[model samples]
Target: MPARADFPYYDGRPVPITGRGWILLMLSVAGAFAALITIPAETFPATLVPASLFAGIPLLALAHLTKRHWTALFGPVGLKQVGQMFLFGILAIIASLAAGVTVYLLGSVAPNPAVAGMGAMSGTAFVLRLIPTIPQLLGEEILSILPFLAFLWLATTHLRLGRTTGIGVAIVSSSLLFAAAHLPTYDWHWVQSFGVIGTARVVLTLAYIWTRNLWVSTGAHVINDWSEFSFTFAASHVPIGTR
Candidate 1:
C-alpha cells in the first residue's frame, strides 16, 4: 500500500488511493460504455456514444494510477463537505437552468434558432437517453476528477509544493485535459459541453481554494454534475418548439 504520507494532504491529513490505484479507472469508464450498450445497439448513435466512452478513459487511468478509485475520481470528500458542495451545485444548476431558459427564449426571436433537440425522439427513446446521461454525470465526474487529483497528489508528495500551488496546477491541468478530450469533435455541441465542464472545473477550484481539501472540491464537482444533469434532463423534456 502507498503511504498516506506519500499522498497529498491539503488539510494535513493524507488522502488514500489504494484498491483502485489503477483498475478502478478502467472499470468506471468501462462501466459507462456498459451503460451505453444497454441502449438497444441499433438505437445508439455512433457519433455521441463514442465520445462519452472516450471521455471516460482519463478518469479510469487516474483511478488506476493513484490506486484510489472513488476518492481520486470524486475528491476524498466527507459528509459536511458534501453538504457544502450540494449548495454550490444548486447554484450551478440554477445558473444552468437560467442559461438554458434564456437560450430557449432567445431562440423564439431568431429564425430557426437552435435548442436541445429532444422532442425529435419518442418518449421511449427519450427515456433511453436518460440512462446514458445519468451514468455520464456520475461516471465521467469520477473519471475526470481522479487523475487530476492524483496529479495533485503526486505534486504534493514528490515535489513538496504548497497546497495552493499543487491544487492550482491540478485544476488547470484537469480543465485543459477535459477541454482537450473534446478536441476530436470541435462542433458547437462539443463546445457547449466543454464550456459547461470548464465552469464546473472553476467551481471545484474555488472549493479547493476555500477548504484546501480534496473532499470539498470533489463534492462540489459531483454537485455540479447533478445540477447539470437534472437541469439538462428537465430542459430536454420541455417542448422544443414551444419556447
Candidate 2:
C-alpha cells in the first residue's frame, strides 16, 4: 500500500466515513442544493454574500469533521505556482469555450441567456458584481473540493475500488454536482450547466488532483471566472452591432 503521504489531499490517510459522517455529508449537500435553488436572480450581486455563507458553512464543517488540513487545502501559492495556475486556468477556459462552440455549431445547444444578459450590465455595476465573487468563488471551491475528497475517501475505502478508479468516479461525480450547483445561475439550462460549466469543472478538478492543493484550483477558477466577467463587461460597453 502507498504511504498516506502519497495522498495528502485525502488527509494523507484513509478514514472510513462513519455513519454519522455520512449523514452530515448528505445534509451538507442538500443544504447547498436548497440554498442554490432559492437564490433569487433579481437580488443576485448582494444575495450572493448570504448565499455563500448558507451554502458554505456545511461544507466547511464537513472539511473539519473529515480532518482535512487547512494548509493542504488553502496553502500559500508561490510565484511560480501562480504563473502555472494562470496557464492551466486559461487552458481550462479555452476548453470550455471550444466545447460550447462545438455544441452550438452542431445545434445541440443555444447560447446561454444568462450569459448574454451579463453583457448588458454597465461597467460600474459589473465591477461591483465582480467584487463579491471573491468570497463566492472560495465558497464554491469548498463546495466542490471538499465533497470530492469525501467521495474519493468513500470510494477507495468503503467500496474497495482501485485508487485510479476511485479518482475517476470522484472527479466525474463531483464535477457533475459542481455543474448542477450552477443551475440557478444558468436558469436551469442543462446544456450550459452540464456541457460548459461541467467541462470547466473537470479541468479544475484535474488541477486539484495534480497539485493536491485547493489554492491552485481556486486560483485557476478565479482566472476563468474573471476572464469571462471581463469579456462581458467589455462587450456591454461596446455599441450595438459594432464588431
Candidate 3:
C-alpha cells in the first residue's frame, strides 16, 4: 500500500522494486523465522539455540554476498565503529541497570512491590547466560531489516531515490513495518503500542548514523538482544510460547 515516492529518501535517481524481489525477501525471512524460532522450539526438533546462530550467521552472509551499501542497509561497522558501539552499549546497559534499581527501590518503599525476575549469580555463570538469547534477536532484527533494505535498494535502482533519502526512508518505513508486525505477536493495540517499536528503530537509526555502516548497528542490535535474552534465560522464560 505504501508508495515508493512517499519516502524522504527518494531522489531523481532510478531505483527498482519488482514483485519478484519482494516475494523473495518475504520468503527468505519467513523461512528464517520458521527455521530459527518455530521449528527448533517445536517438540519434533527440540534443539537449544540453533535459531540464533542459524539466523545471525546467515543474515550477515547475505548482506556481504549482495555487496550492497552496508551503511544504508544495516548501519556501520569498522574499527572506529566498534569503539562507538562499545561506548553506546555500555551506556545503554548502565542506564537500564540504573532504571531497574530505581524502580526496585521505589517499589520497596511503596506497597511492597511484587518481586519479579531478579536474582543474583556468580559473575562467570551470569555472563554465560547470554548464550540462550541470540536467536530471537537475530531472527527479528534480520526480518525487520532485510526486507526494507531490499525495497529501498530496488527503489533507488528503479525510481532514482537518492542515497541519503533512501536511508532515511528505509529507517522510517522499516520502523513502521516492525511496529505493525509486532502488534499481532505481542497482542497489543497497534495504535497505542507502536511507539515502543518506533523508539527501538530510532536507536538502530542512531547506530547507523554513529558509524555510517550496518555492521555496527548489527553488533549493537546483537548486544541489545543479549541483554534481553540474558534475563529471560535466567528466569527460564521462553516468550514465544516455548513451542
Question: What are the Cα lDDT values of the candidates?
Answer: 0.52, 0.73, 0.53
Q: Residue by residue across 1-243, what tens digits does model 2's lDDT show? A: 963244543434444456567567667766765665566645546657555765476657667665654344555689977986897699889989998897677656555454577787876667766766676676677677767877787788778888899899889989998898877676677877888889999998888877767778878988998898788768768777896
Can you give the lDDT of residue 106 in candidate 2? 63
By lDDT, the better pick of 2 and 3 is 2
Best by lDDT: 2
Q: What would the TM-score be for candidate 1 when compared with the true structure?
A: 0.52
Clashing residue pairs in all predictions, respectively, total 12, 0, 26
In order, what is each prediction's RMSD in angstroms? 7.8, 3.5, 9.7
Candidate 2 residue pairs that clash: none
Give me the candidate number with maximum TM-score: 2
- Indicate whether candidate 1 or candidate 2 has the larger lDDT: 2
Error of 3 at 93 (Å): 7.3
- Clashes counted in candidate 3 amount to 26
TM-score of 2: 0.82
The residue-by-residue lDDT of candidate 3 on 1-243, one tens digit each, is 953232212221123334564565566676665565455352212334556644655455454434352223444346887887666555545544554455456543221011122224444544444444445555656666665665576657666888677667777777787667656554454433355445565566566555545566656676665666465545654344654
Q: TM-score of every model?
A: 0.52, 0.82, 0.57
